[model samples]
Target: MSAWFAGLLLAAVSVLVGCRIADTDAVTPVPQLLAFLPWLLVPTGTGLLLALLGRWWVGVVWGVVVLAGLAWFIEPYGKDSEPSGPAVASFRVLTSNTQFGRATGALLAAVRQQRPDVVFVQECDNRRCDIALRRELAVAYPYRQSVDGAGSQGSVILSRFPLEPAPGVPAAMGMPGAVADVHGHAVRLQLAHPMPPVPGGLGPWRRELERLRDFAAAGRGTPTIIAGDFNASQDHAAFRRILDTGLYDAARLAGHDRAPSWPSRTTPVFGVQIDHVLLTGDFSVTRARFLTLTGSDHRALVTDVTLHRR
Candidate 1:
């Protein structure tokens, strides 16, 4: 019975590994499953131990193979990279979802403590908390663009520098973007909060991710940054497709991608890194880390980036 159970567990893990590699994430449950894909290593390792105790050589070999494949999928995350060249401009960014405006005060305090040049906030609903945050934010960030939405749909961008609404860019649901004038150069910023893949939301979630992919593909000519609660992780095929468009994740570059950024209620070990800061053009991330928000489910992602001139 132990051998049989181990074999079945290994088989299920193999199927999951295959689906992730085949990019079947657009389908329901697959996207949801992949969100916690890295966690599968625990069970696969347990199955290998069980197989060994039962003298199930076939199960042990299969378990080893499956575990190896799973490791390959998770290896790139948190990998460090060396800086390339001279910096034209350097800035810090803080991005977070405020949990329907519940974390507004904490978010504001983080802004003052981190002193980020730009802030990307999702779930900036028009409640008393959010309204107060915006009013307080304007004292430091004179340039801003915000669109209030129902519940957790609103998005906002606040910058210490000048900002202009980006023109001619295609729109995705709940994504608010702008162009910031940093040292006389234009840096495009997009605050993204795609629909989560809950029941009845999978289609919209896929479409929203596709839209961001298209947006990234078309904006290769300029320095662009997209930050917020992506509602998808690097394990998702749609999110990986966006990276294929030439954007680099800040956490990945700085060797901190493994630090989970969601479910702030629990310890970091129990959460997943769903919030992200992605960049394109000649930019290099110098530092990346996360900060817990008082009343939010998602932890804020803070990154330092150096933008290189062409």
Candidate 2:
């Protein structure tokens, strides 16, 4: 009976931890752990082991509770069923930080292999980045903006499609942003490399996230995609609210949500997903996944999306 009660208690705690992640604000480091709520599975799994020692019924109840939490927290990344109809237009997009403009070769290789229609690169405001951009991406991605000398305030956008400053935005604001004409579909895109959520930087991080949220709110009807190292995860409240602003996380939409994209050297199973590609409007995510990239602490995210008929 003691074992059974302990198991039930553990199970309840695990469930709460998992559910509360999305609501966890970045006030202090404690609640910030919510960004890694999936890790709660470790404790939840232990509770299952403890319950089995008590009785079959108790074990079963604990199992159901634990599994329910897993399903809820991870369902966004769950495998998706096949779609019935065809889409009107489709294209590939990639977002990579380039690790402060250090991973030139790796970035080039990934670009060559992925062959994305549009690329959003953060930390690209440097000399080495410019050399690589001219040598490797110049001919391939003809329409480029803020590619070099973008500064810490914004990012660079390289695209095969015709790229221009987003309409009505006077100047490039918080994030590196632009609008790309993808086979006639004008899609708004931004490279969002917000300040990290470290102790000293929490204040700036919150403001950066709020800026993105405001962008999404203002661009309600436009097809928008915000992609980069958000530094916050699906569990963070501010990040979740950004999604609530009408953007659908590409990985989430395609049920590939568990694929982590940061701290690249760590095991994919345990790494936190800080990189993301979020979309709004009639974009349908057909494929989304994180890929290995050498020379950077972060992994790259790619997504194939199909647009609805206008």
Candidate 3:
């Protein structure tokens, strides 16, 4: 019976490790399941116990799984590097999914407290919410871009710097890119709020992520920042492809990527870090922190970033 149980545990670990490598979430529910990848420690420890109870093979197999999981978890930290050029500008960014704008009050309060130079909000749907947020945040963020629709089709970018539509990058699915003039330098800022990977929505979700990859690659040498509720974590191959285009996650750069931001307040223990602030081309993250916003399931992500003149 112990052997049978040990074998089952080994198989489970193997499947998880395989998923981590292959990222079988393109059109499946793997992303949702992979969000809980850190929980693999439970089975790993159990397998080690079985080995101590005479099943040495269980320990050997589980040991390999532990190594693979550790490597994946630490991969983000290695991707971050220091800026190689002279400093140009420094600022803070905050991003959040406002649960369809129902968390407007909390989001505003967070903006006031964190005082981010730029803010990206997803699910800020309806016109009334947009007007209210604009009015509330006018004093700090005079420059703004808002794309409104019903349900999850809305997104907004508020910046202290002057903003203009990024002509080089086209809007893809709900993602919008803009150019912000920071101290006379152009910084490409994008708001990312792709379709949720729900049943029958996987295709759109994957395509949106691919577009983001292309968008990042299109602006080769410019300093760029993409922030919002991506609904996909680093564990997903789709999201990683976006990073492949020279972008590094701000949280990862600060070695704080493991701080979960989703499903906040409720089911707080089972949350995953789905929201992100990704950057490329002469940028260094000084710090990253997550803030709890009332009425929203996701915690706001705030990062301090410095851009370098290369």
lDDT of each: 0.83, 0.73, 0.79
What tens digits encode model 2's per-residue C-alpha lDDT throughout 1-310? 7476656667555545544644556356634556676776666666666677666565668666766766676545323333344566789999887776776678889999999988888776567765678778889998876634544444578899898886322223335578888778788888787788777667777878888888889888777888888888877777877888878888878776777887888848678888998887567887887888787788888999887753
Model 1 score (lDDT): 0.83
Residue-level lDDT tens digits of model 1 in 124-147: 887755587667877889888777
Q: Which should have the higher lDDT, number 1 or number 2? A: 1
- Itemize residue pairs with steric clashes in candidate 3: none
Ranking of candidates on TM-score, top first: 1, 3, 2
Judging by lDDT against the true structure, name the best candidate: 1
Best-fitting candidate, measured by TM-score? 1
Candidate 2, poorest ten consecutive residues by summed lDDT: 167-176
- lDDT by residue for model 3 (180-216), tens: 9999999999898887788777887787888888888
lDDT of 2 at 102: 70
List the candidate 1 regions with Cα displacement exceeding 4 Å: 77-85, 167-173
